[model samples]
Target: MDWDFLIDIFQQLLGGVPLTLQLSLLALVAGFILAVVIASAASSRYRLFRWIASAHIEIFRGTPLLVQVFLIYYGLGQIPGLRQSVLWPFLREPYWCAILALALNTSAYTAEIIRGAIQAVPASEIEAGRACGMSGLLLRRRVTWPIASIEQGQQGRCNSAVP
Candidate 1:
């Protein structure tokens, strides 16, 4: 290829960096929120909640991301009443579909990371927090949350570097 032509192509590709970053960041935030919910549910005291969360994680994680994207983007439109619904306007857009797919996919992976991280926290730390008059949300916030956050950060870095 000509040097100038290669440089022009590179420049054009560079123009898409902002969009890529925007999508990644949006997905990251959405996924993190969803992951936290799923992880909480999975670890809940109620069997029903644990079952529901487990099913959600299994369904999402078992499927290919591309398949999920196509199903969300194209399959929804095929439903008889979906096209006429008020939500159709937003669903018809590719931007939302892509974001939804990315968010869902990322959430599944992130949920597993979070669940593992939470489980990895030492029991003694939680006990210590309780002994200090910290219980329920307070104990989690002070003891478990910090350790899990670090694990999440490490896992996120490793995942991002992979293909």
Candidate 2:
């Protein structure tokens, strides 16, 4: 073992801490917002919207992220029209591709967690919101959302404390 070389590599890795923190924080925030959107869509009264969101969640959840990374980074890039499109600039970067894949994957998982949490919320709470003249978006944003956020925060902290 080369002690000096090992120490140098460790120091270099530490230098990347800021970038790692930035990426992780950005992904978490963006993914949370996306998850909320997905949950809302999944729970919508319209069948088409619900089906689209459900299918998105199912596909992302069912597949391993490595495959998604490959598909988004390589497969999509291989398409001639996509390569020529304005999005190609963003897609060409491996970092963004990886971030996009991770965000999408996380959003899918988070959406399920949130959806389950929302469903687990007491029906009475939603009814109470309705009685208060809060239906549609108001019921969800006021009653269900806060509960889900608390549940998610607890889950996140628990998961982080684990090995």
Candidate 3:
């Protein structure tokens, strides 16, 4: 109801924009790296690799992110081994803890995006690669991976823009 109050609040909120921007950009970069690892693991011929990747994605995605942040910060501090470790100095700071949680949260969603995109690539294209004597690294590099890369980039941009 009060225009002056709204403007004052907005101006105050503007001061935090730098921290918000840093967090978002850092999460995006870290999530992109995690997505690549998840995609590779999901596509691997080894069953164990696939299982590990899927489990990691599901566990992170299923939990509430705020709790994850708390757990990483407070929970880690409670552990004697972790508290005494060299990593404790970094993890003891709440800023790094928040960033870690944000990165993991974004990574889980990105993993799903990459998995779906890779699956959307046509099996026929893979067969064609074999027909053309393109197998292993050559086939994946030239055909399968390129198509999936395009889909990942397109979907990632679209999804990140929405929120």
Query: Could you list the CA RMSD of all candidates, in the order they appear?
Result: 5.1, 4.5, 5.2
lDDT per model, in order? 0.89, 0.86, 0.87
Q: How do the predictions measure up, each by TM-score? A: 0.83, 0.84, 0.84
Enumerate clash totals for all models, in the order shown.
0, 0, 0
* Model 1 lDDT per residue over 1-163, tens place: 5999999999999999999999889988998899899999999999999999899899899999999999999999999799999989888998888888898888888888889999888898888999999989988998999987786677646555556
Off by over 4 Å in 2: 150-163
After superposition of all CA atoms, the RMSD between model 2 and the true structure is 4.5
Tens digit of lDDT per residue, candidate 2, span 1-163?
Answer: 9999999999999999998887778778888899989988898899998998899899999999899999999898889999899999999998788778888889999888888888777788878889999977787789888876676666646465556
Q: Name the runs in model 1 displaced over 4 angstroms.
A: 150-163
Per-residue CA lDDT of model 3 for 21-136, tens digit only, reads: 99889888998898779878987899999998888789889999988998998898999999889999989998888888888888888888878887878899889999999988
Looking at candidate 1, what is the lDDT of residue 133? 96
Candidate 2 Cα deviation (angstroms), residue 143: 2.2
